[model samples]
Target: MKKLLIAVAALAAFAAAPHSASAGPCGLPNQTTLWIDFADGSVPHWEMFAKPGVIGAAANFIYPPRLRAAGAKTVYFDLNFRNRIGTPSDPEDAATVVDRAHRLFDYAAASMDCPTPWIALNELFGAGTATPWSATNAQYRANVLAFVRTLAARGGRPFLLVNSKPYTGGEAGDWWREVGKVADIVREVYFPAPSIHKQGAVLGSRSMRQGLRRAAADFLAIGIPPSRLGIMLGFQTTPRTGGREGLQPANAWFRVAKLTALASKQVSGELGLATVWSWGWGAWSDGERDPDKAAAACVWLWARDTSLCDGPKAAGPGFNTSLTEAQITLPRSVQCMVGAQRIGQYDLARLTAMTRDRDVAYSALFARAAESERVRISSERILAAERNVILLRFGGSTSAYRGALARAGASEQVGRGVLADELRRAEIKRTFQVPQPSGTEIAAYYATYSAALARSVEATPAAPWLGGAKRGVALASIAPPQVFKLPTGRRTAVRWFDGIYRVRPLGAPKVLGSIPLAQASGPISIALKQFARTNAFQSWTITQQKAALRRARCARDELPHVAEVELASYLPFLAID
Candidate 1:
């Protein structure tokens, strides 16, 4: 009889395993918390379906015994949210806000049989802080502080820092802003934009490793340690692409192991918890389009090489291949085929059948490069949406924006109008300290910002090829040598690169190396044919450098489920390598 152990978590719990997510940190902690997000973060209503023991939605909540075995001490439930259209400041409005929050708390309490829920509110900056809203900055800050204090009495952990453009709230920008005064665990969002056009690319060029680095830097600068901070990264974008909302690009699973691996060395040790944005749904969310494929990847990311030997053995061809290779028909396909990215000798019949029936992988990189594209086809759209929201609220002649303000007990948009008025006064009185440019100037200022936003959206595949993913394809063909030796005359040495491994020449800048997609983990290997120096550090770089295109193009089927507590709740999602 096979002894089986499974672990899986819902959207919210930050799983902190004792050092391992495929030889790193992606494996969730033994004790997992169930989180419910109120935003439309790519996946909608994931909690209702991510229950433990559920099939299609496998890797639900963890079983109590396994958690106890891990010697975990606590169980948690948290609700994630942002302000309700900017916190109301008036006594009447404030009362209504408090009442509504109470009702939500009551509903959450009744809905789940868990402990007292914690609250995580994003964009904690007052209304005046970020956008030109009706509330004054002081009023906005006071309201947020008050509301948070109220929730703190009932276990609320607000997102004290957020990465909003032009403006930010919470601890990162909280210099004298004082948002941390009313907080208990402050979380920060470190999202990577998916615009990969300058080089041979597919999704956003920003790597998971880079995002975490930036996250760590931000916290470090603010004197905040990882113990008090939580990082929120996304497995997929919210379809804010091409000025259209609700687009699912299925940008493969880029860095599950690598991210965990890097987090182990970089930021994971001190962090209280790390979370992926969603559990997603249906057969379209990145690498999770297929249950079996996703499950296979989940197991690998969760337990690394252990999963390869822990099973009844995969019953299929290419047993030596990794789980991703075993599943993808094309040797280097990275995502499901939505449209033909190649025109040459393709296994059309196989491709066709797979496209219609299964979650197949194709090269979004090849297509984007050929189409003069880089990574992140939707990054611009996300920015545009933000700009559009601001413009619509302040400049657009829309009924919804007007009605929203009117309902907020104001005939005009007090926040937007007042801010604009202040800017105008500043321009007029240099000594009196009033801003210049009233009506036309204010409208024009926003118009220019809006135009820039549009230009970004129109700037599809951003720049020219940068000689990496494009000129580097042939380099990948160099078959991987042994872990420590070169093959015969082959000068190339291969090492896996999920952005976690090193990718540079030792002691010298002239040594040449290339990283192309290996069947599963694309490694960065160098050929120091004549220049191989003694004591030159057998391997080159070890830290995740720039975001690699190959990283975004491989479907790591053996990666773990993003739903934090998932992997442990069910049988290993997949037992294949």
Candidate 2:
């Protein structure tokens, strides 16, 4: 009868194993592997899994015997000596890993209940780190294969823990298939508490189950059998402890445990799968909270093979489960949509004005190439000029300019209108009877605009007019019909053209020799006159722009939906002042 049972077991194992060129079954029974970190025997609620004849595995070597003693059927040690082997391809490191494996196997072999422990050689290729994994590294692959074969030779079970999922193609596929042959592979899955809560209870649970199912399918696709595959669920807390607020509140913990059990069953099917590892239950580090009594209760409810946990479930009175994904995606009402549309239009107009102002400032400061002298311009002409300036500033691409306006919630028409008003105001300033600029103002303007005058002369040599004052010319020529038309010894600003000049009757024209104007540079008198005109125009332009803005009508009614939008928004409630 014993021989027949052995034959039946062998048949079952064969049936569960995948018929592929990969690792055969590691023969680990379906069990929970709890990774406990505290060595001082602060169990962190390990006794919850201590039901009579409850077979389980533990990652840390210190507590397997104690778990067995506490009424567990049989507990196996999952030795975790991570990264002790430096440069896995190195001969010395590979030897060191094998030596440690031997010692661990010997230690587990001494325990009566766990003669052959499942030793995790080490976790490699963590997905959350900057380290990149390459299966193409032949030496590393050879080292891993050698390590697992060595353990199997010693009659010990070896498994590998990895957070990163491996792809199945070319050399990568070859590596996973090779590793899956001798050892079990477990993947770690973690979901932050906030993320779970954001989805609500039911969907969160469903999402987690889907994640596990997908992982199992991925491994299966790479020719790994369900019997040899395993999963490790992370329950860590605090960022320092490598967790994003894991399973906070009593109910969240209960919900995760319940869903995890269901997911495990679905993934493992009927086979005795490797193990479901529970990581991060240790309080060894600061900010790491150990599992509490409620957590232990939930684990007990899930682990025990009894009908005792039906009475006090996590879903009690006042627990809300009505919120769902469907409810979250309900379309907005027509009224609200209309209100938002109106608000958006209002915002666009404001943005258009702002963009226009910015373009105007940019053009004034840097885009001097397109600027030309114009004493005055009509509203339509000014509008076209502003639009042209904006287009030129944005690389002459209408689409780019439109895209910028759209991003700022502005329309091109409104921007042009605002700029037209600005130009009109500047033109209007020239008509003002402004007093002559002081000598101090002229000197300051000369210092600030000497470079500009040089560039202008270089660009248009014929217009030796350095901002309205023509060099080496009779003062009488500065009369009507010229760029700067002003009476003798009298100054006026040409705000529209950004030029201000005063006539200076320095006597009648005379043939002062055939000297080039470049060589016969004008005296300080011509330069000072140019400086005065520029200073007056600039100062008056600034004063008028401010006055126009102050005097401009800003109708609150322009934004019909502003109050409605504010009502629809969170801005009012968020104000601290």
Candidate 3:
């Protein structure tokens, strides 16, 4: 009988081994998407937009080549259609204005290319505010569809953006209903706090959810599938405010997460693309700005965690929740002496490069670094000087001729002075020597390094998964046919045995009769024993036996005999099946 039991165990072990040996599940793929607007009436600081890592946590960018150079894979060009809208001053001029609008649309369509399979149609003029809300509704819809058709002609999906607040009495619902027919996906930009006065309003609040639901219902009503809708989660930072204002202190980060999760859940059960309005806005002064602060915030909010709501709880209800712990602690780290010095040196070098003549070697060095790194020279004064140099060397009607020449003449002197100052401030310079590690130590180090790198890349900004040196068994996939039978004419269900033995089959099952085991008196111990053991009963340790017996004694009335059967027979089944 023992030999027969061993054979049964061996069969189970073989069945389970294949499943247990499988590799870990693949980590979440990058789903985060970002959009920035650079096609307004005036171009923003183009140099700033060009900086490396300046794209923040955005996976996509929406600007011209100048702005898209910041490493974003997708660029959505803002077709500033509002500029073309007008009432002809004379009756004859009306046709000319209309003709001009058509030409502009054709020109823009020809000029741009969608970087990815999906290209967004930025409806800059669709909001009701631009044209009279009632009179322009049909016109707005037609205009947007024209652009979308053009995009489709070039083999790209159309993305539409709409204001969150009611536009000319038409809220998101109305806009969605009107444009839903043409757009492949609809994105709504929600600003919880329209003004500072409205701060602390529940953004992803119960009301917000209701509003979204209403908008969604309208879309559904208009035959727009829920799968095609996305919301652009963001907070507005005005020049008056310091850090991101309108963020609920308690729920700032949580709100962002909740909304992201909610939108993802609502849209397609997938976190659709999101963009933080403008990464470099807020209190960015040329000299005092820390670009990484904004970038870190962007990363923290968007790609840090897959689910926003799954993260740590906010401090309290109705409390501001957007400000993350990282954001709170940022003020302290923002002033890092060494880091700040490096940034300042980089900025100074950029300034010097821009001011110097383009023909000079030093100018080339600075321009190369700035262009390569995408660092924006924030100071208009510096940009002006650089322009002057470009004009002087290149000649023609250029912006800043004299300043570039003056900086070029003094480039060597300034470069030397800056280099000397930096070297003098270096506090510690040392070379360390150590004996080579043994093979075992070397193998362990490599393993540790690989694990750390994997975790770092996989870690979400929202809630990072941490690891340590302690040995702990990872819960792998649960085996199939989790139910089992014993020799005592009884059946039992198997489940993970931590401190408690959680039955896999929650209720009565057809095949397996209940076991007579009692609840575990204390933590139930389990481990992978020798593969040679035929019957798992032989591999069951004394502790496991004792715990099984204790749990059997306390088996509930509903499952009276669930503990008596020897669970050891099922040990091989514990291997992920």
Alpha carbon lDDT of each predicted model: 0.29, 0.44, 0.31
TM agreement with the true structure for every prediction: 0.35, 0.44, 0.33
RMSD per model, one decimal: 30.5, 18.7, 33.2
Ranking by TM-score: 2, 1, 3
- Tens digits of per-residue lDDT for model 1, 1-577: 0000011011112322222211211122332222222222222323222323211111113422233233321222332344442533432233444545555545443332223433445544332244333434444444454455444444433344443321334422553233333343333433332332222122232244345545555545555444344544333333542111222232222223223223322334334343322222323455434333333233223322343222113212322233332121334433322133332223322332322322221221122222222222233433333244444333544566556544443333222322222222222222221223344543433333221210000111211111122122112122111212322222232222111112221121111121112311111221111112211211211111112223333232111111111110111211000
Measured on C-alpha atoms, candidate 1 has an lDDT of 0.29
Model 2, global lDDT: 0.44
Report the C-alpha displacement of residue 528, candidate 3, in angstroms.
65
Residue 410 alpha-carbon offset, candidate 1, angstroms: 73
Candidate 2 local lDDT, 58-166, one digit each (tens): 5444565665566554334443444433343342244455566566667656642455555654465432222234332333444555556555556556667777655
Ten residues in sequence with the least summed lDDT for candidate 1: 1-10
In angstroms, how far off is 369's CA in candidate 2? 67
